[model samples]
Target chain A: MAKENKEVLLQVQGLKQHFPIKGSRNVIRAVDGVSFDLYKGETLGLVGESGCGKSTTVRAIDQLYRPTAGNVLFEGVDLATLKQKPLIAARKNMQMVFQDPYGSLNPRMTVSQILSEPLQIYSQRKIINMTKEEISRRVDELMEIVGLSRFFKNRYPHEFSGGQKQRIGIGRALALNPKLLLLDEPVSALDVSIQAQVLNLLDDLQKEFDLTYLFIAHDLAVVEHISDRVAVMYLGIIAELSPANDLYVEPLHPYTQALLSAVPIPDPKIERTRERIVLEGDVPSPDTERHGCYFYDRCPKRMEKCKGSIPELKAVKGDHQVACFLYE
Target chain B: MENKTILEVKDLKTYFRTDAGIVKAVDGVSFRLDKGETLGLVGESGSGKSVTNMSIMKLIPMPPGKIVGGEVLLDGVDILKLNEKEMSRIRGNRISMIFQDPMTALNPYLRISTQLIETIRLHQGLDKAEARKKAIEMLKLVGIPAAERRIDAYPHQFSGGMRQRVMIAIALSCNPEILIADEPTTALDVTIQAQILDLIKDLSEKLETAVIMITHDLGVVAGMCDNVCVMYAGRIVERAPVDDLFESPKHPYTNGLIQSIPRLDEKGSGRLFSIDGQPPNVIDLPECCPFHPRCEKAMDVCTRKYPPVVSLEGKREVACWLYEENK
Candidate 1:
């Protein structure tokens, strides 16, 4: 697929999400300033470690948390400026799938009720009008779509395994046929074999429904496998953004290089001889204000200029963009 | 460096008597840990990797959970046969275990110094002053900055990575012969995980402490373990040298696990090869091969009976009908 040929489904322009401390004046710049474009029917992976604002990015885009600053252009309409009623209407096109399958689904409700709740609510709100029989039919279709047996519709969440519960969650997300799905570490909780199954199901679902996805995960390998393009986030900002293959093959940012090196390959032969870049300390607190680049203190390739000013994400190659002095 | 078996588990069976029926959590698991050698127990959730270790540690809650049969031989002494008092001496002094979540493992109310000193004092019979000094030293060894000053701080004061380091510090304070690390870095980030793994690798080599690493992540197993045991439905399905296991896996489950993970080195847009069906429930599990239903190359015999363990070349052993003829 050509890059320029695809239409932009969601455009996040200089998005910032900041939360102030209760008693203190200090603010946590969770998603300081992020900008990206989600193309139609494409999966854009947001990869980062914990507290890197990957989840916050998805939430801000989904309007779960109103952004502190900047615009979210969804289908050429500014979602950031929309009121509660209009925002609710805009959200019909987008839906979120959470990480923990055990916690996500309601244990009390059966699979049918769990899947139908979203449809019922959306229909009641006049987002989409559907008859009860049609709702029942759609629920059955969703079960088939996510590879769950329709016979298990009356079963409670506790009866289902972790993988089955995840399928139910996916089915519920697809109830209204949302154009975009915000997958926030959907398969992280699952076992390796089950993780593979879910990943493959997501791949098939995207193709079958023509749904766009903003996949957020800490696992680089999983993201690379699914994402068309990858964005590596660090301390609330994207350090590098490129085509999935290009980013993994030739990482531009030092953080991306270090992160890539840190992940141990499954093969013992490769893992034994491979040199890992083990970062010295933990990620710095997001609450602390910094004048320089977010990665300056921990960065191995830190320069004098990096401490004085922040580096803007700039394109260095055809599709690879990096926010580092080395690239500049 | 001659290889010597320090810990030998012989036909260990830990079962849980649930309302549904007897859940064979760790059913007849057997393996040997060489001195200073890192042995990886690789399995998914409820595959009995954790139960096997817990049973060895004698930490399983009885009544509901019971070690029905087994012999955990440590230096020719059957630790499983020992009384509660006798086992307590061997628990931390000889064989220390670290859990996945450090927060839950460490007492939040107690200061770092209290926990560290208590373990050191109990095992080494050291005084408070000497124990505190050794605690700081152990903390420093695990790469905790300002160990002397932070020794009084609570577990909540430190970050997740630092807290894990504290757990490691306490675990290794006694300089145990065998250290059982059960998913120590699973709760951490990739960068922090690398740091923790490197520390463990370096410390194990320095202290000559044998490590039994139990984890679901094959990447961790590949990096840390000299030998690997792939568990399935509370049984050791396959056992092999780390290199041979990844190079040429004999069991269908091991092969499926390796094929399933998206590789960091490999660049492919194609669909990942996923094993069909979920892991079997262990409660009242049939006598036949548990993984046969999900196995790609399951034979007719696999459904009728459990496959016998076949010894292959390079010290590898696999329990599968596909390799039964090789026996």
Candidate 2:
């Protein structure tokens, strides 16, 4: 396939990762044949259900789980085929900010040691063995950057609240100063008031550092908030991909339509007026095989051909790609 | 226009006695629920939304958590007056709860039927066969197909959304007049969360049951609730009709929350209006308004003295000094 402007920072092509089921010979298609392009300085929100390969795709991109097939070209280098040393070296340019602040960090490590470990692994010797004054200054700078106070440096994860702890997580991620940050539901675990603070902090940091984000979340409202472009994934495929505004207001795929309808609009009047598209049935197990569309069972506008042949992602409008039989 | 109080919580304060110091989780929180109406308890985590709900049901333990003050009245009957045996009998029979994580709520080893039957027999006083019959009905009511066959399946056999349905079915098994749902769809995907919310709304309407939905998502409350109570630092900061709360939120904390939430409609808006400070420690909550530390419209009185509830006509009450400006 031919590409447009070369501003693309990461190009994921036909990424497939299948985790073998415990006893059964069948493989759970955690992420299968997924493809998307993330541009420089753009926040691409990946929205989906719990089991849907959103997390797996991000993990695969981070090289935590190597893809069984396909390619992840990071800055024109194929990361899927890289070995141990090169992969770890490539990791310097890519950092992952996990979801649970409490579970993500080692509880035993103080905030100072936690931040310094990354610096020791990636930074120079002179920078590593700097005086206590210098180390505290650097940690304080990072802490202040994430809106955390200087006093929180010596505190453990148990001492700080969920929101304050997440700030420390963000500070550690920024320590690497990577070009790309893979945020996996970064603010989902925090409280509503704290979520906004962290989100605003992320926005400010992104602008200041010119960082590109692969923002993964389950909530469309938060996704719509930060994403320049959005991708709707179901069972392990990109069902809809378009700019955030175009995708939310004028969704082409039935799944996208239902997802938009399902979100409870914060306005009571609008909510009362809006007809909800309550989808029937549960998400099929990833191990289950489908002949055509992944969303066919619950899709409101499911067509006969939707079962006959798997629909390919075709452009419904300019820059709007949808994989549904309705377009055909 | 009508006063039909289903649940009346009076000066309800549930404190967790920890070694570091006592955590005054639900500090002097008071509210009323009307029959067939939805009241939303909105707050960030640790604001005690869940703690308040748990205390009303007497789920909080003694060593760590205790309801130190106030009475919880349900249909003119003070639930707090009941002893352990009485409280146990009334719980799950009069009022039920559905949690955020369905997996944790349902037993993985037991069949869905076994779980549902236990709830039915314990509360409804049904025989084994009769409980089984009701379990089938509930499964069907929650839109689980082949309900009879699926009822015999384990929790692992069902999907995340279906397990949530089972949780709801168990919660509604006793047909309680009041249902307390604490972030019922928080971790689920967007589509599944939507369906669960839709189910709650449809079922609540059909049963004409009062619902106290505890959630951080303003979107969920806007759609499912008739009225909302915004809490911060263990205090109800604002209470109003859902629409009015959204259109004109008077409390600075409420104001901050509404602005901070990334809206589905507000596509190209700038960065969300984040509240500048953290929620104060519940143990060391401000003597004045709890939200005064982070409030943009904080006044001198806001720091030294607590603000009184200012009434706006039509059941809206805001606890903020800026509402005095409106007056």
Candidate 3:
């Protein structure tokens, strides 16, 4: 839960990312008018399916992809309008951990080299000529933070296992001591046994470093486990946002309810007894513009009011916001 | 023969001759499936769940992959001893399989009607028109709307969920006695996964077809399987009824796997219960219990040798040193 007195570290206002086709007028509306806030020391989980724009939203916020429209405010300053030097300085406080541990880290470089590269890049801005001793000490500290031993620092990324490779990725992300971590499905690629280990390590690191995280994943169980607040995305828009437990227990949006019900429980007795709400049809293509709700085509409880107009996200309960008109 | 067992695997051992060494993919795995029953083969990436099913199918390539020792009895007949001609006849007609990715399993260039009808023609020996008619019926049976019009479309034209439905339609067209669905719904979204699971369950019941569902997800096993076999490092560590396994798992590995996954119905302690180490390397596994290094309750004996299967009441069985004394 976010404390009332905590400062808003990052605020995303109406973030839209649209990619235009080269030969056609069609645009892939990846992220459309998404908004959210992150407290100084909290994990905000962004949950959605593959094409739901959670990845695009995170990239836009990280400035990996500039937004087609709207603004990403990091401590009340728009990242889109910042100068090159200022943006580089601002990015020093924010870091992103990618999904594929194998592809995200450089395969050619040793763990020591990978960890030192970030420090070397940021050293010129800090204006301190880093001595070899200081860089080596920092690398050892980073490896220790991510539960890797100093003995294996010289090994390349290929020599390490999937879990160990993920540890290196996390270590490199923390090399510069960033305040906010944009973790995009960090544990999804790992095996179940190793996933839990990496997840625990991440939880511990967040507290130890006083870091805020924008955690993105598709697994509802994982998101509910780690997130203080959970946002459900559908067709490039946030369908609902609520406290993690509350969202799980009593979801406001139809899409959220369907997603929750679809997660098969591990207990056979409970799984057999529970009624599942299987939505009809596939997710519509994002290239086509829908006049109303993105979920209107599949929603069973859809009505006349659901067509020809979009519904803005409004608070339905305490700290629970839904974009559906059912609450109204 | 007296029992209702539809498929029985006895001492299945599959190995691969790699550059490093002989990798024991499925080391002495055994299980049984009755008529109309679903047996879930649950395991991690290298745990050999897929290899076990492939060995049964006689699909392992001979040069590198070999089924060195095993008897896959489909209705009291050894499938492994059968020649290539005999195996091919039985493969699609009696025991069929649906792969993980429908896009790859389906040919991109061919029409949906072509792929589905070819299987029907091959298995049932029906003529072109009859096979095409049966294919459309199968498509409608799996819940693809406008089957007549969409039958001419290519695999890319259909959505992921619909392509999977087409795959399921092709798998179930011949109404095989056994269906091997290896992660059938893993590629689809959750809502679509639910629909596909329901369709499989409903269709299997109607046709009285036994299913061998291979997947890593415990949740899918809980909903779909009557019996569950938890595989770790090429061995069945635990086997029991789904309810029994969920309520009281005996093996330390099974317990760890259950605890490691976050449950949607319950709020966790914030600190996740994680298993300590990676799965043992199959190429050069230790002689002792392979999971002893990571098992929290590992005794001295656990590190010395692999434990024998300890049978308990209610058809429950576990291979662990903790239960060796009880046995």
Candidate 4:
């Protein structure tokens, strides 16, 4: 966890993802001007509620969605400038695990087929040239690493449980031994018991492979558990960013404070006594053009200046950044 | 002194006649809801939490889903014995429900006013104009902005959070004695979920309605409910007050569930307490404790025979072989 010699594996700068409305000229700014640095072998969590553009940010970083602006530099190479073939080649070091285990995997294919299909397809890219026996052996190794029994590889996805299906998904993501793993709500779909199992597995795998993770999730608890550093996003921008512990303990931004407060802790005594800052309104539509702060309408400490100018993410405390007029 | 029991479920056994086998969806589930209280039915998917609620509502299809045995008492009267017409009268009037997804629960083709007014008129016997006014009031009560105008809008016109507010409006339109919300806020955001939960809590308190909240989230249970029932493989494994359940969970399955979830309060040690193995198949559950396979402290007797329910002090109860001697 030492930062002295840690290399920045993924440097995302001024990334913007805008979707054009079908009939109208207006566009939805799903991810607008977000930037972050993911250190090698350290997990950086992206936490936000629904429609806050956390998923879009991850997707843009994964190059699944072509960004409208800005650069995604993976080990100094700008991924946004790459063509389809080259991008595919670049994606070999970066893989993603989705939230829904049931929908992510192919239902028709057996687990063995699902695991091997990735290797077979990527082998055509010539990054991995393996014989049939080597492929089988690697597939089994992936399964074992993910804690899935090798004997259950022949079973269809439908036959396995939610946790098992997720393990298979993780196995497929790790099939190529990617340096960076983009986990988008990996454990959110599983049961609490199974979720913990998967979280522990993810932790062990991180150490075993030195995997740097962009752990994207809505659950604050899971994010705090898995992430070394955490970024709080709201309406397509980073509201606050700091070490995971510091962010949770003393959130600088009002949005981060409100979001952390809104999450109900399991302890009945603490929950009853804790003062929650429940925001009044829903997240505003991304289609609306705003000159001021995106969270101005809902911020508890909104000022007259917040209505006129957008606050940049400025450093407040040690390594902690906040985007608000109060911080300015 | 007898606490006024609004609803009581005794040995409820509901099964689905699937091609695979008779799936014991809700097997011998029992619980009680007092007047103006919230009871949390916590469980994973297929754990029979939803089915138990469906059985109480008489919403289960008879051919596929049959209530083989049970006594569901609403105000000391057994509702399971009631016919379809009588049950229909009870539903949406005395007992109402809000489903999981607001988008799917509300008809997209129909306007919000139409859905709300229809339920209002049918349940309250109000005139069309009067029902429309009442529907708008309900919507406003659930914090829908511009209720008078938004009432005429279709379900698609509203956001996910707003649609959920509409669902709450319809559910609370009749001001029923009991309200059953099945994963009501699961589809919404945390902030939105907080808003909806506050609305439900506030409305239930104001109306003095007993609520049966069926959800998979323990945090929601801790914040909202007075009592909690942890279910597994179609059986209630533990029943305790919310405070007791969270502080010192009794059953092994309950303990595993609490320890498994990462808490927002404190940092974890890079590992979580995990319950190994999947839940047992409901169709052919073992004669012993269904959780024995996954239980860390499972004994030989656990796999040999079913554990009896042990009632501890402070109204806590657990079904596990570890506490078998106390039964």
Candidate 5:
């Protein structure tokens, strides 16, 4: 699974995002010192349970919720310190697709308007000077590229189905032709039938455009299907990062083993017979200052050492990094 | 069949009168549940799994949604023909349903204690103190820790997985005979999903109640269900033992569903092959096989006419022309 070029497109270093609780005087470490690299033209799947800071980390990368402290180097540019204008300028080359397509798109805007506005802003051409005919032509091309028909160009967001609305969202994101896409559970909202269609479409689009993707999702099967390398996030920290094939086949970390064991296999016989590692208790409160591994309380294989020091993510095998005292 | 049948639904059709058309959400669907067995109803969204469950409980709204037809027979009694007085007694006491979204299914304003106890008080005819005691016990039953403290907390205070457990506790308050969970873990993460599913399995063993689990996740069905029912566009496409369904799926739709679920074994074999198209629009569906449009192996007869249930010797039934006697 090793890449020939192996060029890093985006590198996140010690990214920390701590939000102050409304009444309490303590901070909720949503994304506490998370770091990972996104290689060019490759998809890195980020997975975790809800409140494990998977969404918070993606929000930080998309600059929607800026990090409290830490560096986000997109092509060696520090986004943490970038001014408003530069942030806007940088956004032209970066785009996001959210979990809920219904809530993300403006209900009133036509598909052409939604697609054209981004182009109109980035191109800097006089708005009125560009005729309606020209703007629609470009929108149609974008639709066709996304495998959506041009018949949907004039339709409102409400008129289209959930899958079609998602296509519109993809079309809008593609309007800018961004270098990196922070897709946050983009296919989670759709049904399995449509989800597969959209996922396959994404795979084709990635190869066609040579786009880099930061896919944040809770689905292992889908993420493992789509991702090149996947980072398993738990309580705002990555427990394991490895090639998707390796992670599934030979997972090292106890948490990864538990996580993989917990996933029900599609084969009924195997699913019935396989022994599952059930993690104990809910994910510990990130608002509290946690000791040891964030998963120590729930780790089925937790040891006495796991309660003392937080294990660093270190290489256990070729391109496979695991953060656990057992591995250490 | 006397001892085997737990719940039987016959010719149940639930419809919604929308502005566009009358959506036949659950069109002439019939199935039976065995005692202490989990029947997994698998389908895409709008395939009427949820609607069928809701219709059985008579929870469908009057103006837009109506039961329209069929009888929901639980333990030889026709519950569908029963009046409101009878249904209310059966609703939470004999049969309970767990919705997909725990956040919305639970009241944002009320504490878990209040929600759980109110149902117990109404159904079980318990006093305030007695209901409170039962609620705490029910909470503990679902594996929620420190139930005495967590019981009084509102839905917002709990996590997604925990809130779902609360919903389960409420559903199991009266120790119902049947539990209909529609996409119970769809909103939660996979890790938590496994936990909840295991909890359900353990609880089912303890309670010995029939469970109708409706979901799109074939992986979950494979693990959790005793029998799996594949639904497509308001019709049950295939119904068989879980092992038989996965090992030798006769129906094209059933085969497609298993293929669509990405597995570790599928890696380095071939790319993920999706079912070609979406489920048919429920309203005004065509008179042929509902799966004809997306079906890779569609035949002339598949589009011209619908396939009847090709019943096998031991309890397997598939609705595909490929299994027809004439074919």
Candidate 6:
């Protein structure tokens, strides 16, 4: 957990992704001024409600959608400034596993073909040179690593169940031996039992490859389980960033507290007795320009200053940062 | 306070006639719902949790899907035997259902007023003015702000959570005795899900309506339901009180499911306990236990035949070979 010696694998500084509406002057700021440092071989969990820009943060970091502002420093190299060829070259070190496993995989292609597509593309582009046999061998290894049988390589994606399809997705992501993996709600679509399987597989794969992960998911329990550090986002901003235990055990931000309280504990004795902090109203649309806090409307501990100015994420305790006027 | 049994489902068998064979969607599923008590049906997809509730509502489509056997006893009357005309009177009047996706469940083109008023008028025999007044009241009851104005707006104007609130309003407008909410909070965010769940819990208690919450989330089941029914491949694998089910699950499948979920309260960095193998495909399923392939304590008898339901102490019921001796 020491930060002095650990390398920063990815440094996202003031990253912003904004989409403009057609025939309108308004822009929907999906990811606005988010900053974080993902340590090497560590899982940094990004959690929030839907439309809170959790997915957009990772997508923007992956350069799936070019950020409107700020820098994405992957291994000290600024991905935001990189040109098309250099960006593609840099992308070889980072791969993204999308949320929907069913939609991500091509229905027509066989499992082997799907897993090998990345390798073939990389080899064709001279990013990684490998013969057809080597690619096939790597696919087999990937299938094994992801706990899928090599015999199922000939089967199409449609033949696999949700969990199996997700395994295939994970196998495809690990095809090029990327140092960093951007998992965007990878296990959300699967069942609880299968979700655990994929989570364990991801944990093992990270250890096996020494991969740094920016795990994006809404399920807080899953995030707590896999992440070394957790970041709670709200309407394109990090409300709180702390160690997984600290964030869960002693959350500073009101939004974080409310979010944690909302997640029902599986134990009935605990769930029935616990006091929940249910926030009022829906998440405001991200389109309108906001000078004040994004969560001002629903924040239970809102003040006059909270309505006038946005709070900066500052350290209240050791390594525990919160964005609220109360902390100030 | 005495508990009154409101509905009793006996040996329900709902099947789908597919090209491959008959898919036993909800085979031999039975449970009892007491008045004002919340019951939970927890299972993964294709485990027939949703189908069981749909059969109770008589909403299953014909030709492909059919309720071949079983009786859905409401109060004292067997509703499965009721004709289409008779079932129509009972469908929305006495029993109501809210679906998973509020967006698709609601009619986009129709105004909220029209949808709410139509249901109220059809069931309660209220006139236009009274029904319109009652519709706004229903909307207000579900915590929709400015219900009078929002009632006139179309469904597209509302957010996902607000849309779900509207769905609840419509479902509970008639004050149905039994409310079946099928994954009501699945499509909602945690904050919004909390709001919806709180509203449902509060309103159900206020209206004295029994709720059958069908979801895959054990957390939701633990918090909301009085009794929990764990389903695995078209049959109830286990049934117990919520506390007992979580604390000491009898069925292997239920125990696996309870342990598999990463708990919010527990602090652990260890690898999650996951069940091996996938749920069996229900198409042309055999008479043997479907979960035996994934169960760790699977015996020779589990592969040969399905285990009979065994009633244990504390009113728990389990359909596994491990509990067969207690039968």
Model 4: per-residue lDDT, tens digit, B192-222? 8888999999999999888999999999998
On DockQ, the leading prediction is 6
Model 5 / residue B234 / CA error / Å = 1.1
Consecutive 10-residue window with the lowest summed lDDT within model 1 chain A: A1-10
Report model 6's chain A TM-score. Answer: 0.98
lDDT of 2 by residue, B1-327 (tens): 365888999888888888778898998888889988899999987888999999999999887888899989988889888999998887788899999999999888898988999999998788999999999999899888899899999999888888999999998988988899999988687778888888898999887778999998888888889899999777788999998999998888888888887788776576677887778888855578777778777778888777777888889988787776643
With a 3 Å backbone cut-off (N, CA, C), the pairs that clash in candidate 6 are none
Model 4 Cα lDDT, one tens digit per residue, A248-307: 889889999999998988888988898889897778899977899999989898999999
Off by over 4 Å in 5: A125-135, B126-131, B268-270
For model 6, the superposed segments whose C-alpha errors exceed 4 Å read A1-4
Q: lDDT values of the candidates?
A: 0.93, 0.86, 0.91, 0.91, 0.87, 0.93
TM-score of chain A of 1: 0.98
Better of 4 and 5 by DockQ: 4
Candidate 3 lDDT: 0.91
Q: What lDDT tens digits, residue by residue, belong to model 3 across residues B1-327?
A: 233898999999999999999999999999999998889989899999999999999999987999999799998999899999999989888999999999999999999998999899998999999998999999999999999999999999998889999998999999899999999988877888999999999999998899999988899999999999999999999999999999999999999999999989999568989999889899967778999999899888888788899998999999898887742
Candidate 1 per-residue C-alpha lDDT over B1-327 given as tens digits, one digit per residue, 9 for 90 to 100: 769999999999999999999999999999999998999999999999999999999999998999999899999999988999999999898999999999999999999999999999998999999989999999999988899999999999999999999999999999899999999999999999999999999999999999999999999999999999999999999999999999988898999999999998999667999999999999988889999999888888888888888888889888888877742
What is the per-residue lDDT of model 5 for residues B1-327, given as tens digits with 9 covering 90 to 100? 235897899989998999989898988898999889899999888888888898889989987998888888888999888999989999989999898899999999998898999999999899999999999999989988899998989999998899999999999999999999989998887778998998899998899888999998888998999999999889899999999999889899888878776775457333667887667887887789989999988999999888988898559999999889784
Give residue B190's error in model 6 in angstroms. 0.7
Which ranges in model 4 have alpha carbons more than 4 Å from their true place?
none
iRMS, candidate 6, in Å: value is 0.7
List TM-score (chain A only) for every prediction. Answer: 0.98, 0.94, 0.98, 0.98, 0.95, 0.98
Clashing pairs counted in every model: 0, 0, 0, 0, 0, 0
Cα DockQ of the candidate 5 complex: 0.63
| Per-residue accuracy of model 2 over A23-110 as CA lDDT, tens digit each | 9989999997899999988899999878889999999998899898989999999999999778887887789889999998889998
State the TM-score for model 1. Answer: 0.99
lDDT of 6 at A191: 96
